[model samples]
Target chain A: MIEGHDLDYVVSGIQTLHRVSIRAEAGEIVCVLGPNGAGKSTLFRLLSGEIAPRAGKVTLLGHDVTTTPKDTLATMRAVMPQESVLSFPFTAFEVVMLGRTPHATAGETMADRAIARAAMAATDSLAYEDRTFSSLSGGERQRVTAARVLAQIWEGEEGRALLLDEPTSSLDLLHQHGLLETATTMAERGCAVVCILHDLNLAARYATRVVVLQEGRKVAEGTPREVLTRALLADVFEVDARIFVPEGTEIPVVVPRGPLSKTKPPRLATGALL
Target chain B: MTMAEAPTSRPTPRAVARPFAWATSRSFVLAAGCLVVALSVVLGCAVGAVHVPPLEVLQSMLGLETPHREMLMSIRFPRVALGLLVGSGLGLSGASLQGVFRNPIVDPGFLGISTGAVLFAVVAVVLGGHGAVSTMRTALGAPLLLSAAAFVGALVAMLSVRWLATVEGRLSLTALLLSGLAVNTVAGALTGVLLYAATDVQVVTVTFWTFGSLGGATWGTVLRVAPIFALGLVTLPRLGRSLDALVLGDAEAGHLGIPVERTKLLVIVVSALLVGAQVAVSGLVGFVGLVIPHVLRLWAGASHKTLLPASALFGAALVVLADTSARIVVKPAELPLGVITAALGAPFFLALLLKERRRLV
Candidate 1:
């Protein structure tokens, strides 16, 4: 439902994403995995139309993202950014209701409220419905935000897409699994789900397809069993890792041993040593 | 898994009950606001220099004959109406601008919108020659010209401040405050330069006007500026949803399908028009916009849908009541409307600064 073709993005004369082409079709959970500064967030931004790619184009539901009206695009897709800073002290329920903004209505209706409540329940955030969002813990806030995007695409209409950026970063282990299971549920409902993830095992467990990135380039793309090998992890992430697939299952479990030895320490884009 | 099916199943009773709570509270605030405006208007008319009494004031409003008919209709009524318009205009502009900027502290006065309007209005009066001040009352087209000039000035100042605060599509609150200070300083300096060249009579007129008053209010003045204020009142509330979306940073607001830049532009222009026309009639009334919205937000929460209209009503009442006190505080001599508002608003502003300091630090 969402496609980015030959995408190239640059910031401050440095390329952040180069020649990256990716697509998520209906009933697919495409997990994008990469190390720090691997251009995953940049790719997410490009697909969500937050920023235009310098080269190539993006299409969502068969319409050019750049040419489409934002209101029209919003109805077909919902994006959850890595972090959101709210200026005012809106209640969690109010924050979730914002997800229904793209729908055609002047104000919140009974149906919108029901959908928002359902989304909150799904994310385990209904317990704090009346609490101010700023008062919530980091994981609580993350789940509330997750509920917002879920509320946005609650209709489960065909050709819809949900794009999540590092949604699990602030989540605890159980909620992390809960959020991914929700994504899987969305995929099963015939919605395209593109998620950027840091945990390989979670990606391996939930992703129908995996796209791995290394230094602004797409290094691997296939099913987790075909693409998530120890050699790929060593080459892209610079880590010694083992991939174990149990005898009865096709799912691969990744266990990292340690960082791979290198001649030099890692450097940032600005050449600052880390 | 049970939660996943909640969309099709009935929501908890508590979930169904909560939205009504906010809705009812909002309605109460709005209703109280209307009552306050009515009471302020009555008190404003009755407690003036002539002391018309509430009964007679109500009679006068109903078009009955009273001893103070000419005084009430010609002087006090227009003044009270002007106060309402100016107060509500400031209040609405402040609320809308604060929402658009996503900052609670910034208002028309702080951002130099009022000063810009004053600068241009002063220039029009001084350049229009010796009789221009009096012409504002007598000449039909003079107030229109002055309002237009003020509108242009306000638009320029608002746009400049927005431009200075924005970097890489992000609006920095620190930059917004600093740029506002810069704009206010430059506008004040320019007004000072104009004052240096004025006659003694012009100086007196300019000084009194700059202090901000509804003393110059007339039916004609009210007629001229009321349409602009009404226009803002109608249009700004419609933008509440967009502004609500905007409170969640720009990119996220866009993700919700708001046209962020366009909404910002509309807010700027409409608020400029409101403040410009208001300043032309009421001078630089400080803190009505800032204080009104801040107070309303505290009472009604931060949703602009309620905040905008509530600000308008409460702002009108506050200004009208302030104007009445301005009339009675010094007794028969009348204080400038700006002095009373500043007296009330400055300390409130200080307290707000302290509250925000915790967050900033």
Candidate 2:
């Protein structure tokens, strides 16, 4: 479990996060959706204990993370950053084995190796275990990094959280679903999972709960059906969209009607607003 | 896909598969490095002004007195030991620095560290004001003063470079390398002024050191420098995991439970100790650090767990071989150790640069 209360963060004298509060519990997938610079990464950083929030408290597994030692917090949560830039030519296996660093006191143990390999296999990256990380394609590299963080929390019990920043950005459609499916499995095994994503339908399909952000503040928070309405998209994303609900489903499938034109206003099928 | 039966009982993929992958296996490279180092140590002991055979060298070393025993014990042994020590120090320091910086091109002297040490050494020589030969013998007597001066100089320069490159606790590699360039130029200018003010004998002494040499190798100097090198060797191996984690960059390394700032400090301090100590004893033996670690990485892969130690072995071997060549290549008159190292290093470096030309431009 992870909770952020009224979190405020400043970067380079500019307020990037403004009194943001959010929480994640075990067995749930929470997706944060926003435009560029919506403080999604900043929020992840604060939750991961990389930076302290000026105005709020962040607690992980009931301990105040601001004062908690990083090594102690490490075993409870794993964070996969936006980009993993490496100059050294480490094999994918070696890169993932780095995830077991916090646990292993000396060199790697047999158990650590098993966990790393299992995580790689889970991410469908076992085929590239011998390949150098730098030689992998973008999607492959992203998945390998995901495997690394997964290996970090592979054996943890409840109260563990996985924070992913744009995990599927480089992934193709099928791989995107596969990555989210893996995250869902992780949640099923009693882990709190939070992902920041750009695609709305993906969020609607995978996220049990969604939080919408505009600029740096949270505008709406609820289940995917309640929060991702046509009105919310228009007001927050500044776009005209059609919301489609297929039969026997409550999940909203959003279809964009292009940008809100200045010369010619948006047309609605209802015809009342025009 | 179905979950595996026992998650924890999965195959140990790292060991079970690609068992001979030289890059990832630590023991193989370490064993090879030890073997090569052992061969080079024997070779260093054998090939000198007097070409004692390897069997004779071993026999003399094991207390079986040969006709060349006196020469072997007095001149060749101390020189070989010092070469091993200094070479290992330089190699390990360079590897650690490159790992911390996450740039293969970096060396122990990357932050103008060696320049600072050279500046202080030149200052000590100019202030001593004696004949080059006499100064060389006695400077080893004031080992504390000289080593302290060099260490302080390196620490100050490194800190300044760090200060210049750091903003709000985050380090910028671009700024760090640029500041290193700036500091090196200023130190070079200072050294030039000292050289200009020096007497003729002092000029000769300063010039000898600036070009770097192991001609002054003695048991006393080797003993004086050993403890510092030992300190670095002890600290570096423990940093293997953190350095490996650092390949992912600072922020991500921290996420992996490494204290990034502390690790960087530890690397800098150990690097300074090793480089400063080597400069204090052997002057600036160029490229042993840069060339050895790179060759090892190219041949055996870039795992720092082995890269750091293997570099020490290869570096010691190369230096020993080069120093041995320095003695015999010009029989009666020995070449400066630095010249020989540069002769070997320059071509290898050029080859590497040509191979990496696309990235360089």
Candidate 3:
């Protein structure tokens, strides 16, 4: 449902993403994994239409993202940004209700409210519906934001896309799994789900496919068992790691030993620490 | 948290009940705001030097014959109407501008509209003729000239700020605030220069204009400013949903399908026009814009749909009441409308800041 072709993104004349291409078809959970500064976020930004790639095209749900109007794109896809800061004192429920803006005609309707509530329930955030969003804990706020995006595409059928960027960063252990499970459920519902993740085991468990990036280049793309190897981990992530598959299970579990002695500090594509 | 959650279910009763509660409360607040506006209008018309009773004012409003018919219709009614328009316009402008900038502290003054108007009005006082007295007489003779000068000055400042703040076709909020600050400082400095060079009478006129008053409200002035205020009243409230989306930073608002740049531009232009016309008619009325919306946000949650209209109604009532007190507090001598509002609003604003200091930090 979402695809990028020969994407080349340059920042300050330095190539951040070089000839990278990725796609997530309907009913597929494509998890993108990379170390810090591996151009994963730059790729996500290009696909989400937050920034335009310098030399490529992004197609979402059969339309070119660059030429399509934002309102039209919004109805077909929902993006959960890394962080959301509400300037006003909106309640958690009110924050989720904003996701209905694309479908709402005049104001919020009973159906919109119902869908928003269902989304909040799905994310387990309904308990704090009346709490001020800013007053919520970080994990609670992340769940509320997740519900917002889920509410956005709640009514849509096939051909929908959900793009999540580091959604589990502030989540606790249980919620991290819960949010990925939600993404898996969305994929099962025939929505294209593309998530950028740091937890390799969670990605291995939940993702139908994986795309690994290293230094602005795609190094591997395959199933969890095919792509995740100890040598690949050493080469790309600069870490000594072991990949073990439990009995009767095709899922690969990654266990890190330690960082390689030649590990280089991650640097932005612009060569600036900032 | 569940290991494997069930499929999404219907909202629980608690989930359904709270929104309904807010809905009912919002309606109640709106109704109360209407009542407040009505009471203030009647009280303002009745409490002047003549002391026309409320029953008499109501009868006059209903077109019945009364002893104070001419005084009520010609003088008090127009003054009240002007107050209603200017106050509501300022209130609406402040709320929408705050939404666009995603900052609660911003107001029309942050756009330099008030300073620009003051500077231009002072210039018209000092340099419009041979001496300050002749210019004052001319201004009294033809009020449009001064109003037009002030409006033009406001437009100039708005355009300059817009130009300076635009970076590659997008409005940068930080750049906008910095440019507005720069414009205000320059205008204030120029006004200071004019004040330093002015005669005593000219200085008094300039100072009084800065203090703001509704004493100059006439039928002509009311009619002249009505269309602009009406334009704002019609357009600003319609932006409630867009403004709500904008409270989340611009990028997220865009993800929700809002045309963030266009919305920001529209808000800036409309707010500038509203504030410019207000300053043109009534000299720099302070704090009604900032305090009205902030208070409304605290009372009725921050949904712009409810906050915008509520601010308009309560702001109208507050200004009408303030103007009434301005006329009657000192009996024959009157305080400036701006003075009364500042005296009331500044302390309230300080208290609010103190209460919200932790959140702000």
Which candidate has the top score in lDDT?
A: 1
TM-score of chain B of each: 0.92, 0.88, 0.84
Residue A66 of model 3: what lDDT?
82
Q: Write the per-residue lDDT of candidate 2 for residues B157-200, one digit (tens) a residue.
A: 87788788786765565676688898888888999999877777
Residue clash pairs of candidate 3: none
Interface RMSD of each: 3.8, 4.8, 4.0
Please state the error at residue B182 of candidate 1 in Å. Answer: 1.6
Please write out the lDDT profile of model 3 over residues B231-322, one tens digit for every residue.
Answer: 88888888888899988777788888899889888777777777767776677788888899888887889999998888888888989999
* Per-model TM-score on C-alpha atoms: 0.94, 0.92, 0.91
Docking outcome class, model 2:
acceptable
DockQ of 3: 0.43
Q: Tens digits of per-residue lDDT for model 1 on B248-343?
A: 888888988999989988999999999888888778899988899888877778888889999999999999999999999989898999999999
By TM-score, highest first, what's the ranking? Answer: 1, 2, 3
The prediction achieving the highest DockQ against the true structure is 1
User: Which residue runs of candidate 3 sit more than 4 Å off their true CA positions?
Assistant: A264-274, B1-24, B124-183, B196-204, B356-361
Model 1, range A47-158, lDDT digits (tens) per residue? 9999999999999988999889999888889999887778787889889999999883577889999899889888888878888898899999998999999988889568
Where in model 2 is the C-alpha error above 4 Å? A262-274, B1-24, B109-111, B128-134, B162-178, B355-361
